[model samples]
Target: MRPAVFFDRDGVLNEDDGYAFEPSKIRWIKGAPEAVRAVNQSGYLAFVVTNQSGIARGFYGEHQVHALHEWMAAQLADVGARIDEFAYCPHHPEGTVTEYRQTCSCRKPQPGMINELSKRHSVDIHRSIMIGDKQSDLEAASAAGVTGHMFRGPDLKEFVAPLLKQLPRIR
Candidate 1:
């Protein structure tokens, strides 16, 4: 099994403009692509895990979320980075859309997404790490048995460098 780096989509990969689904509203956070590239170059699988309550609230559809992710992946690819997978939760208990209103396990603060990724990718949870700007992100990481790094910084690469450096070199 190999180690992986899980990143939160909003606030970490892009500026969180409330319910940002439009392509025009997407703004990549400083050094976000470079950070993912570094992880790729280091041979670590990179993934994005996010909670898209907007889908449940009727702000956007699942297709729009996928389109945004595709755009993000293309942007990363342009910079020689790649995200192995994307896990998103479009469910919320209080959601306006009846179909999306049920509570689900894939949401953050739960390990559903991470666990599923681990199973699919054969990732070593103990060796993996998650980076995000929220406490819920850390809680999810902990529940998944992975180290969680809180990012509150000037740039994504700068904030992630030291943590990446601490990881033992994988053969």
Candidate 2:
């Protein structure tokens, strides 16, 4: 099993513009793509775990989120970076949409998505890390038995560089 770097989608990878779903509105955070590429280069699989509450709020559909992720992947590919997988929760307890209104374990602050990813990808929980701009991201990482790093400001690559060095190299 390989170690993985779990990332939160909204504020970590792109500028969070209040439930942004449009491709035109997608703005990469400073060195976000490079940070992902660095993880790839370091022999760790990269995965995104996001809470897409807009889908449940009726601001957008799930298809829109998929489209946006697809666009993001294409953009990252242009920079020689790639995301191995994406896990998102489209459910919310107070959602306006009937089908989406439910308390789900996949939401942030919960470890459902990370746990699922670990099962699917054979990820080493202790060796993995999660990076995000919110406390929920750290909470989820802790729940999933992985180390979490909170990213507040500065370049994403610069923030992640030192931590990457601490990981044992895969042989």
Give the count of colliding residue pairs in each prediction. Answer: 0, 0
Overall lDDT per candidate, in order of appearance? 0.92, 0.94
TM-score of 1: 0.98
User: Per-residue CA lDDT of candidate 1, range 1-171, in tens?
Assistant: 999999998999999888988888898889999999999988899999999999999999999999988888888999999999988999999999999998788988998999999999999888899998999999999999999999885699988788889987778
Model 2 lDDT tens row, 1-171: 999999998889998888989999888889999999999999999999999999999999999999999999999999999999988999999999999999989998999999999999999998999999999999999999999999986689998899899998976
lDDT: which candidate is best?
2
lDDT of 1 at 30: 95
**RMSD per model, one decimal:** 0.7, 0.6
Candidate 2: clashing residue pairs, number:
0
Clashing pairs in 1: none
Q: Runs in model 1 with CA error above 4 Å?
A: none
